[model samples]
Target: MLASVHSEILREKLLLPGETLVVGVSGGNDSSALLHILVALNKNYHYGWKLHAVHLNHCFRGEEARQDAAYAQELCGKLGVTFHLFEFDVPAYMEQTGMGGQEASREIRYGFYRQVAKEQGATKLVLAHHADDQVETILFRFVRGTRMQGLSGMPKRRWLEEGSIELVRPLLHVTRKELESYCEENGLHPREDSSNRSRKYKRNLLRLEVMPLLAEVNERYREHILEAAEAIHQDHAFLERLAIEQLEKVLIVRKPDEIVIDNEPFQNCDVALQRRMITLILDYVSKQTEWSSQHVEAVLHMSGGSRPSAELHLPGQLVVSRVYGRIHFCPKGREERIHMYCYELPVPGKVWIAESEVWVHTNYLERLTDWERLPENEAVFDADRLPGPLFLRNRRPGDRLALFGSGSEKKLKELLIDTKIPRAWRDRLPLLIAGDEVVLVPGVRRSAAAPVDERTKRFLHVRVEFGEDWREVFS
Candidate 1:
């Protein structure tokens, strides 16, 4: 195991002789093996490397966590290496940040590691993520709806926090089983946390339940996944270079919290580059570690939209908007407060759309009214066909509507643009929804789900009356 890790480090050019390094030790098999391996290599080869073992006790497991920290310190003492232990309240962090347990733990844990590295003036922070861990990560991201970049899994080494510190993983070629066996052979007596077996966490579930099932189907699952990941990494690396070049070319403004790009030049680039460039912007300004592909597509739609200006409100207070000929990304309180609203419409009653200043009136009738004369402002539907009570809300991303004649669903944003709706008013446009379906867009169009036909016994007469001219608001 030591020989393989050394070979991996040398081939990847992971370390230089006598460089200061920080190794994270969790008192588990994986991290313990990593720390011991580095120590062995340092002494045997006369590398003269300065190694610091850092352990963080996330205040969750009570006595078990404290014991883990103590064990890490004892091991470091036995190896005659410097050790540092820190305790942090992960639950409080999650509560304050509204992040999940796993996400908060990782965020604070890496942050603590980086701080220690900076204090020690070390450039490399080593970890023990192995081949099996890599496979799990790839599978997790695949299930969570990611792009090609995520499918590549973790890199052997990457820069953390804008290239200030290097994060190195020398065990990518090793397996967890091998690490455990090495610990047994060396009498390391690594400590184990009870939380790893908890089924409440999705990752633990995957490892404890899903992984063995996959192994049952194919014993070489880990090798196959890692091989595919390596291939994807190569392809993504090529596209990443292109994306960086494209971003530099189209960049009009760049800042820590804001980015602006020339819209025309961005559009001229290949569709693939465009997507990657936007991802680069997101990495810079967005606070979240991961973003869904739908978020990227929404931004793309906004760029090609007919509206002269528009804004897409993303989670974590990040705002992506188009202004004239430039696209801008702003994080941290760009807008004071978003005015998007939703309201329930009562059947056989009336409700008012506050933003659009229109009244929605619904009535049940034995015979259908002459709604064809004003299809834009009124719709007659088969009462029995509505999925549920009508709901009035503003637009959401991926909202689709089925037109009267069109067999397929049309993206609501594109439909609004086709009708020449102002971007400013689009978000405030009243949409009557029935269950998951958008049944009516007053002064725009109606859904095809609840059609009025001669066979219809009961009727749904829905009408909207604008305080001002409805045409003025929509335009």
Candidate 2:
């Protein structure tokens, strides 16, 4: 059994030499047995690595929790691996945070493990989710109306945060029966977690009850479950790629808060692709709660104009609002506001704004006589002629601007009104300021103070374009 798991690990390239391995030791049979097998493998195979055991204590079962922590500590001591433990009152956390019992416990436990892994400089954190656990997860998500990704179950390895290491499930292909058999064969004493016996959990019921019925029908029931999961996992990967492509093509995104979508794409796409697109939108829009099929269907129904300017308040502060025949997804309380920043125009560099990119080049400076030729959101300035240092910034109340050829002080809002720009659009418009004076409002007006002339030594030529969406292209 160890040899087969070792072969799978090697085949998957799950572990690399010379990196710290942080094993999540729950003091349960699965985790404890996994630790023993990995330690034995490390010693026998001369795998160059450092090992540390992490135990997250939810403090739910009192002495039972302490016993689990103690057992993990003992195992770490016997194996000469460093051990770390953290405890939290999960019940209080659930009440305060409004997260459910299992959900809160999982979030807390994984959060602790990630912090520990970072502190220990671990390259990969190991989990003991065996084949049966994956099957249960797939079934659970299916019952919960999950799309393709959830039905695929847990990934074998995924980066929790890129370059911060990953959570790896090396025992994914290993079964509980196989692990128990291996433990008995090697005379390894493993502690059973008492919580597993509680049939209150859906997974517990499946393991103790539903699985027996399936096994009686076919002795190779576990193998069938594993095979089905593998096939679903492949399908999930394909659909994920498709979803990403659709997101890139049709997603109307605004950074950190808003995403606007046109109804045309969904109305045009096949239902399968439409479901995939919905999953991508929910996942990318915000780190919201697990989206249900009903939520997607509701959004789709809204896209079909089920209501008059309807709004759906989703989990994680996401607000889906329908306005002007487009569905907009934004962080709650953010729709009525615009966050604008005055940024420096670095010569020969790029300026990023919501759904737009501005490239400033010296050669492009000659093309503009008046800023009116610029997009309603762009402007150009003579770099060398600006009063000492130029600054990019926001509009403040009582702010005055000198309209070119008209020396009278004009309010920024009044100028925006004259230009026929909406109040919201005006809020995000970049205002070029030079020494407390509005030098230029790109794509709008330029100050009489700094007019482009042949005497201008260095020119700031800016090219700005807007689109429905933007991405972190450099990164």
Candidate 3:
């Protein structure tokens, strides 16, 4: 097994002469085999690769985790390799991020690995993902309605942290049984993680229960799955290149917080390319490559819609909007607040607020309607007394508003709380601003300073709507 892995690494040119490499050792059979084999290759073949071992104690399983770290440290010590160890509160991370145990552990583990690689100045980080793991990953994604990208499973080599470090999995071609045999044959007693046998986790359940039953049907299931993944990965890579090319042609604007594309060209492309383009944009914007099929389908449907202006809210506070002839993808709150910008409202026209996903319309009225019967979302102002070029924006600090019929002015924050608005929505709520004063808060209040009177000659009618149905708010 070691000879096979060493030959594969050489053929793949995974390691360079005298280059520093960080090996992630979890004290499990796979990592233990990886560390031992690499150490042996260095001694015999003069591989000349500087090896450093890193172990993350995922503050779970209490004493058992500590023991695993200690064992990894001891093994690295015996091999004359520098050992690095760190501890992280993974349970706390899971709770904070609302991620499951497996996801949280993997995220924390790789983050620590990246830090160690940077500190050690190692260009490559080694992982111990094997053939069985690949099979499990493909099967898991298959059961979850994956596309070709997900079907590709894990790549053997990829760049981490924006090419700052390389992650290599040399064990992808090797099986778990072979790794266990290699460890036993070399007298390397790897520490066993008891949690692997637990069925609470999806991966564990698949490994312990589902995979064995599948193996009964065909013992070569792992190899077949690996082959399928390889084929899918090749096709995915080619499509990704084409998608990127298509994106370059249609993408009109690309910024850190937002991306805009010409909808006509994108809509005319092949559906496959469209999906890839959407995924690429999403991954670039979110800084992750884990979008679902449903998300892509939703964007596709929105892109194909005939509405002059439409918006779809996605997970992670992302909003995809189609306006005029362009499609805009932006985070709901590009920063802490929904982009503190004042957009000039067009008179007798409609303006779409990307941050709030609300449409604001202004109309010139010859006569005022009954004030008591008007919807709360609609506000009438005396056009002759109002300032020019009214704008819509979020509330700024120290912003005060005088409600109609109220004697005193109050801060916007105080008004929001009194209205029982959610604290999270306070900063993102839309406010109609004229010059420096907040005139109206949609579905909330109309300022006393801008009320229409009996003597008014012209009236400015403003209304706000949200979502596909343009649900009207009556305050």
Q: What is the C-alpha lDDT of each candidate?
A: 0.84, 0.72, 0.83
Q: Arrange candidates by TM-score, highest first: which order? A: 2, 3, 1
Q: Output the lDDT of residue 119, model 1.
A: 94
Model 3: which ten-residue window has the lowest total lDDT? 466-475
The lDDT-based order of candidates, best leading, equals 1, 3, 2
State which candidate, 1 or 3, has the greater lDDT.
Answer: 1
Candidate with top TM-score is: 2
Clashing pairs in 1: none
Name the regions of candidate 3 deviating beyond 4 angstroms.
Answer: 255-258, 308-325, 329-332, 335-475
List clashing residue pairs in candidate 2. Answer: 342-392, 342-393, 378-442, 378-443, 379-442
lDDT of 3: 0.83
lDDT (Cα, 0-100) at 322 in candidate 2: 71
How far in Å is the alpha carbon of 168 misplaced in model 3? 1.2
**Weakest lDDT window of 10 consecutive positions for candidate 2:** 466-475
lDDT of 2 by residue, 96-134 (tens): 978777878877877877787888888898889998888
